[model samples]
Target: MFISVVIPTYNRKPILEKCLKALEKQEFNDDIIRNYEVVLVDDGSTDGTLEWLEKNKEKFTHVSCFSQNHLGPAAARNLGVTKANGDIIIFIDSDLVVTETFLQCHADALIKGEKKLGSDRLFTYGAVINTCNFDDPTSEPYKITDFSAAYFATGNVAIARKWLEKAGLFDTRFQLYGWEDLELGVRLKQLDLKLIKCPEAVGYHWHPPFNLGQIPNLIDKEIQRGRMGVLFYEKHPTFEVRLMIQMTLLHRILWGILSLGGILNERTLAPILQWLINQGKPQLALEIARIFLNWYNVQGVYSAYRDMVKN
Candidate 1:
């Protein structure tokens, strides 16, 4: 069987190098995975990503790069899926550097799962360990915060091409920062797709260490995520979707209280965050920053919801 590792990239050329390098080192049995390709879709990256990849084409033997306009991951991923030649499609982010056993683990899990379930009606989900260690992301161990119960996140998931086409791929309406993959998950669930957990397959998700300088961009992403969350709920207007989008009073009250009614904003917490960073606890600082970040999300969700109602 052949596999296609589909990755959508924006302006993330630095870690994309590591990601492609790691993918080139994958080892697997010929029978399990006869061949594999990396379908990398460059979503209008301004950082010369496509040019660099082209220049280093000889280095990334398995990589096939494509370019598109500044559309979101949903569109980029759809283009990748539509153009992929492999029957099995594994979705991962551009910043994710995976283990050598990543493809083999997914293949093994898929084979066993299909046999046990008596059908090819399932997809394999792998573990994603988040880290700030740019030099060596995989060196970081799994933490409680890294545990994800998401049904169909794209961080590390492998599925048959047929099911994704049937489910209509990703909704391009999700052109914002979040909820695109999960929205596709809702559609895949409607098609009765099963989730097979593959713990053996791991991917190290790389992100820069948190600092006070990043607060603005992080906050903007949270707000954008909030806007996209409402779009997700609109597509699937169910209680579960509402909960996922944080359109509930519980979320509102929780974030509000934790943020002290928006008083503990980035401005107010900048000193403490910088101090923690100086103390070499940027992760903790990020956690504390989440207090206000989540508040911005809740407010953005409600504001977008209100605007939707008005329109």
Candidate 2:
């Protein structure tokens, strides 16, 4: 089947370069795979991504670029799907770099899954190896932190285009940080769609090493995720949704205890975190910082939920 890889990016030109380059080197032919296209939707990037793509279009022969205003990824992805020409759509982040055999592995798995299931009511989720090594992301081994049990994440997944249309795509209201994809997964699950793991289709998800300078941004993201979590629960309103958003008493008590009721916060933990960074263990420092980061998330969720109830 033909495939359209949809990527929604915002100010991620450096990594996007590696992503597109990897796609351009896919080891698939037009016979079994039929055809494949990379549909890149730039979500109003100020990093001159559009101009760079235009000048370097010859490097990516299979790429088709589009642009939108500063709408969130949900909107940008909707535009990508609307413009895609392939029946099968692959969703990936701009920061992910894949192997040359990535598409072939997904295609083989999809074909096998369709044959085994007697229908095309399944999506293939690939393995994502997280790495802080930008120069050689693909060389990084899989770590425990990279393990994800998510049913459907946009990091590296392939599905029938019709299923996404049936699920009505992502809700634009989740424009803050997270849960937009999982909310759509809820609808897709209702439609009896299955997720098939395709371990061979590996993608290396790249991010810079954790540092003290990134603490503020990471905290802000957790807060945004918390607010968006409330929106997710509002749409689904199921026990599963509550657990996913961490709106339940279990999460509240857990984070509260871990953070010592907000006493062990950024201010209190700054010295320790900085010491870890100085010791060349930024990853460990980030992990330790999660104690307060998650506490902020729990607090933010409850605060937003309370505001919603008040209104």
Candidate 3:
């Protein structure tokens, strides 16, 4: 059971270094996982990522590097899948640093699941603990905010290569910030693929602590996610998709009430958010900022949907 860990990275060289190091340290049974390779697809990063990887190739012996123009993760991941030589594919973000037992845990889960289900008609979803501790991301304990209900997110997951091909891979049209993975999950669900939860296989997703300076980038990401949500709905046009994208009246009313119809935006919340940051409560500030962020997403999705309809 050779494994190809497909990682799509942009300008995340710092954390990507940690991610690759952790993968290099994975402890797995040779019988269970004959060999594993990290298929890293750099999406045209101008940050000397390629040069560094090339220079440090001796250190990352298990890594095979690929590169593309700045085509976003969807396309980068597709390229990885195409280039992968392993029958089993594990998808993880470049920012996620994992335990040494990560690959072993996923392999054990897959073996058990295949035995129980009488076939390999499933994928393993690993736990992702969000951490702002860049210095030691893997040391952070899991928090409620880190919990995810996503069936098939790329942050940490492993699937049989054939299943992904059967599901037709990810839609590159979701070229924006979100929903590309979940959109593919919808199709994989239709193919009767099961999600085997592997809590033992954990990855610590590292990001810099939120601050007042990040509000604009955060808002822009929300807007991009919203636009991609519309594209997701166009392809899957179901009530489930509508709910997932928060395109329904329920989301509109909920975000509207929470944000007071956009009055509680980044501009209005800057003072309070900055205060929280100063008080060493960046996470709290980020959560509070979500009120307006969600509103922006709701509005952005609706606006995109309207534009799509008009055209």
Name the regions of candidate 1 deviating beyond 4 angstroms: none
Q: Across residues 8-123, which tens digit of lDDT does each residue of candidate 3 receive? A: 99999999999999999988665898888999999999999999999999999999999999999999999999999999999999999999999999999999999999988999
Query: By the lDDT metric, which is better: model 1 or model 2?
Result: 1
Model 2's alpha-carbon lDDT is 0.93
Local error of candidate 2 at residue 213 (angstroms): 1.2
**Prediction-by-prediction clash tally:** 0, 0, 0
Candidate 2 on 1-311: residue-level lDDT in tens? Answer: 89999999999999999999999999974466989999999999999999999999999999999999988999989999999999999999999999999999999999999999998899999999988888888998988998888888899999999999999988998888999899889999999989999999999999998887888998899999999999988888899999988899999899999899999989899999999989999889999999999998998899999988998
Model 1, C-alpha of 278: deviation from truth (Å): 0.6
For model 3, the run of ten residues with the poorest summed lDDT: 26-35
All candidates: TM-score: 0.98, 0.98, 0.99
Q: Enumerate residue pairs that collide in model 3.
A: none
